[model samples]
Target: MNSEVILTCAVTGAGDTVGKNPNVPVTPKQIADDCIAAAKAGASVAHIHVRDPATGGVSHDPAHFREVMDRVRDSGVDIVMNITAGGGGDWIPDPADPTRGGPGTDIQTPAERHHPVGELLPELCTLDCGSLNFGDMVYVNPADWLREHARLVQAAGVKPELECFDLGHVWFARQLQQEGLIDADPLYQLCLGIPWGAEADTETMLAMRNKLPASAQWAAFGIGRQQMPMVAQSVLLGGHARVGLEDNLYLRKGVLASNAQLVEHAASLIENLGARVMTPARTRDHLELRGAQTGGEA
Candidate 1:
């Protein structure tokens, strides 16, 4: 088992959770605060996704991203910034015209999707390995699109967190590595429990983790109730852990959770298991991260 672990907190994802949980951050300041709080609570990295402040919905505006980045950087937090480059891939079929995209269909070219990551240049950014049936919609990241996106991320000198939602995604991610698109020691995040994606279980996590490159740095997270269980399982399986409001809304049954609480709980779990939490500096070194300031190392 891995004795030292890096815990990442995905502060606010671009999901329909604002109404469900009032504490879910929407504005740039709130998102930045949550990132700082999670770092103070022992999260080595913060995975970020900005929402439209007026509507509190998913957004791809570089201005919004810049505001959030500025706040986080100015806050003097030592945590690594991991911006979400996996946006703009949602596709919903039109009820009237089934052949084309629908009202909720938000797709973009590789350059458009990579705009924020390229402009702000976060230390780490996520690249969803492949597409999957996400509830009624489909998250459409095709092979060619992924190839171009990976190349773009590589040229930006940022580490792409290969987000694998299923077994096929793992296979595809390995293909990207073999083609040398992933420059640094590839970082992987086995995303579980999304609709129609990989199931949240020990066997599934192990299968996905085992398929990773031997030199790759990997972590796994489960959505909803399986979040904490997967953290323990990941660590026991010699991988890192991820937690925060992005993946789970509740700290326990019927309890809404903040990003910091989730990070605190994950840190406690790592310590209780006879392992120490890796700091942001250590994570940067381990993952070979490129950007972000070291204002106040946690």
Candidate 2:
């Protein structure tokens, strides 16, 4: 019943979703426009991930991110930009060697993964808490690497959103907080329903929420069909909600959706739950986020 639930729209993920959904935005212009639409529809935050235009594959290119940032700023969307610093950690290890990596691995240094955040210095950025068996491949992020990344991101004056895929990851995030690697008013994104990660259900969400530090601020999102359900759950449980093409592509069964449509749906649900969606400016103030930079004057 609290009117404090902030809505975040993850425009397009770095997943293999472009081919699956025609509505998925590929170009920077399209992505920015989608983000603007989402903001218009009541999304307080816009989480971004750039892709390779040629293959529609995930990319860590800072130039692509720059293009997206420029376009979003130029559009004057009034949405908090939260860039992903979680890419470039994928590793498909060689079965034969076991030590060396195999092809299809987009392995890069932690610094490489954070290049966009370091350069652009968005109001918010993601810091994936732990490594996991992401499907068949291993998403590698050791503790040392994460500590270094936390230090670098904090130093850059960007608010780090701790993304935890499981309970153990949350534990690691707490360790980071205890070590003062992250700020006191830390933000967390509870990612559920991923392959081999936390399950998407009320019990799992409640358990994770209960474990969070008292000083921590957080949001919860579920993938696919559980996405909308978690929106209501998150709001009812005193947390924010996120939804969009990144987490889901369908507005309903067999119905394709644009990012704005997802935001609209989320807003309706929040309103139904007796909660009102906050604007980006309000969200920035609520989370104590640094103000965004004006690149192209949007």
Candidate 3:
């Protein structure tokens, strides 16, 4: 394990998790509270994704994001905000007409996909590198779209975390790097265990990590039962770690967990492995991020 490992706590994701876990925060207030709790518990960064208050589904409402950010700021916690630009990519092709999209497919233009990041201007935002077949719906991000979003994020002065879900996605991200669309020493988040992406296993992660550029700052996460295993794997690989209810719901069998609990568990594991957990302040310094507006320390 690396001596200095940064731990990120992903707040409520934009999945259909509200019904699966009672602890998943839905409204802006609940989401903000969850993020604050995670930061207080020892998360260096909070990876956030908002949901609709009425339906508990994915939402791209900038107002909702504003509310969450305000609450987090008002709480005085020093968590590095890392919002998602990966939503609005789900595409369910119409069964009747394969050329058309079906219901539940919330595809948006590159500008719309990255609009929130431009408005929020967080220290960090994710830019998914490529599309993958996510079960029934295809998570689509063509190269042209990715290029546009990359430019927009770079222009906004926000660091883009290249989110690679598969091997090909990594290749695409490297292409962006070579094109100078990404910043120096780019950050990466390898999303493993999604339906058609890389498996959440040591070999798979090792392969991807070995393929990364020498100067990349990277983190890896797995979903469901693979989450904890990937945490240990990522740490051992000298990379950052992430955990939250967004990826996994249970701390143990039949035991639902809160975001803070998940982050605490990751912190403990990192500590037990003789690796120091970086606070949000340290993380900002390490990542070369501009300090938050409130000047809160991690």
lDDT of each: 0.91, 0.89, 0.89
- Tens-digit lDDT string for candidate 1 (82-119): 99999999999999998999897999988899999999
Query: CA shift at 10, candidate 2, in angstroms?
Result: 0.8
Question: Model 2 clash tally?
Answer: 2
Which candidate has the highest lDDT of all? 1
* Better-scoring candidate (lDDT), 1 or 2: 1
lDDT for each residue of candidate 2 in 1-298, tens digit (9 for 90 to 100): 3567879999989888998899898887788888889989989999999888888888888898889889888876688999999998888888888788888788778889889999999999999999998878888889999999999998999999999999999999999999989985889999999998899899999999889999888899999999999999988888999999999999999999889899999999999888888878778778877863333221
Better by TM-score, candidate 2 or 1: 1
TM-scores, all models, native as reference = 0.96, 0.95, 0.97
- Candidate 2's TM-score reads 0.95
Candidate 2 lDDT (Cα, 0 to 1): 0.89
Candidate 3: Cα lDDT at 164: 90
| Alpha carbon deviation, residue 163, candidate 1 (Å) | 0.5
Better of 2 and 3 by TM-score: 3
Candidate 1 residue pairs in clash (backbone atoms < 3 Å): none
Q: How far does residue 20 in candidate 2 sit from its true spot (Å)?
A: 0.5
Residue 114 in model 3: lDDT = 84
Instruction: Show model 3 residue runs off by greater than 4 Å.
Output: 292-298
Clash list (residue pairs), candidate 2: 73-298, 76-298
Give me the runs in candidate 2 sitting further than 4 Å from their true place.
95-99, 292-298
